[model samples]
Target: MAAIIGHILPLALGVALSSVPIVVMVLILLSPRGRWSSLTYLIGAVIGLLGLTTLFSAIATLLPPAPPEAKSPLIGTIEMLIGVGLLVLAAIRWRRGRRHEHNPAAGTPKWMSKVSSLGPIPSLGLGFILMLRPKNLLFTLAAGVAIGATGATFAEAVVGIAVFVVLGISTIAAPIIFAVADPARMRRPLEGTREWIERNSSTVTTVVLLVLGTVVVGSGLAHY
Candidate 1:
């Protein structure tokens, strides 16, 4: 379980560093119906990550068992593919960030304009949809594969998944936590934080993807 946790930590980091979700979360928190919407959105996001990761882990458990030190061609191939995909995504993000560096109109997603008006159910739905975004999906998939590869007992697997889910959602959860803890004091800082993250999201994402892609690629190669 410890090994599995270590392996998935970087993947979780990839998910946690995703700025869009954090930004959307901030918007939800800053809304007129902030409290309930933020909570439900978080709940939806949790359900999405938990369900998908569990599904992937179960599917991976169906693969033929292998010794810890032995090569696994199938898993290796999957990791390689995922890593390559991340690298490609990183490249795209880097280029897009560069291209739009001076364009104030470029970065925000269209749906975000509607975030302020979202009710609890819509916010919840939005949260679930956020997990399906390309980067988040890939990271969750990688973490699932890592957990499944460990061949841990059911209890251990649960623990591992729990850890992954917590870390994966930490960023999105943090602002909600702080805001709820002290809405009066937190609103200003949270707003500033949101703007900063929105401005630099692409850069942060590019660097994270590049590093994690290289790490996963290395792990895959080690199987041989």
Candidate 2:
């Protein structure tokens, strides 16, 4: 039992941390203006997230089991790569934002006007697509493989994965729910928060990416 518990802890931590991007995405989603319908948006977001979780879990199951020797280093490398990529992306975004600030119209592309028309289904789909990013997939796969290798029964790992995935999804969905349900009431605050985030998004994203990448890489290296 002690051994089982020990194995589960690290996997859980990794899974929890992997959800950070989702949380950040959710915050951005809620920042925009709309006629908020919390219930609809929440339900939609949950459904979308669950679908993604299910898809990822299925993919994890289908993967050929990793050799024990390969697990740690591979996972670590993946973490490091993800972290570095995020930082780089963040830097690019920051630079772009700076350029846009100098030319206000630069940030407000016409296509963004079409985003509001996307409705709940599209919004939910967008959320799912966000998770499918290469960085997220690599991290999630590494996490699943690491957990699976620890000798936990498949059933136990599934349960744990499900729990973690739900938590991650919920972190993002909460804001979507709020934004959808009361756009008018939320408009001012959401806009304020959105503006702040937008203003600092590149820096914030870079920092978070670096931190998460460092943790993942460090965890991997420690095993070596």
**Which residue pairs of candidate 1 clash?**
none
How many pairs collide in each candidate, listed in order? 0, 6
Candidate 2 lands at a TM-score of 0.64
User: Top model by lDDT, which number?
Assistant: 1
- Candidate 2 lDDT, tens digit per residue, 106-130? 6544644455555555555555555
**Residue 199 accuracy (lDDT) in model 1:** 79
- Clash count for candidate 2 is 6
Judged by TM-score, which candidate is best?
1
Q: Whole-model lDDT, candidate 1? A: 0.88
TM-scores of all models? 0.96, 0.64
lDDT of 2 at 65: 47
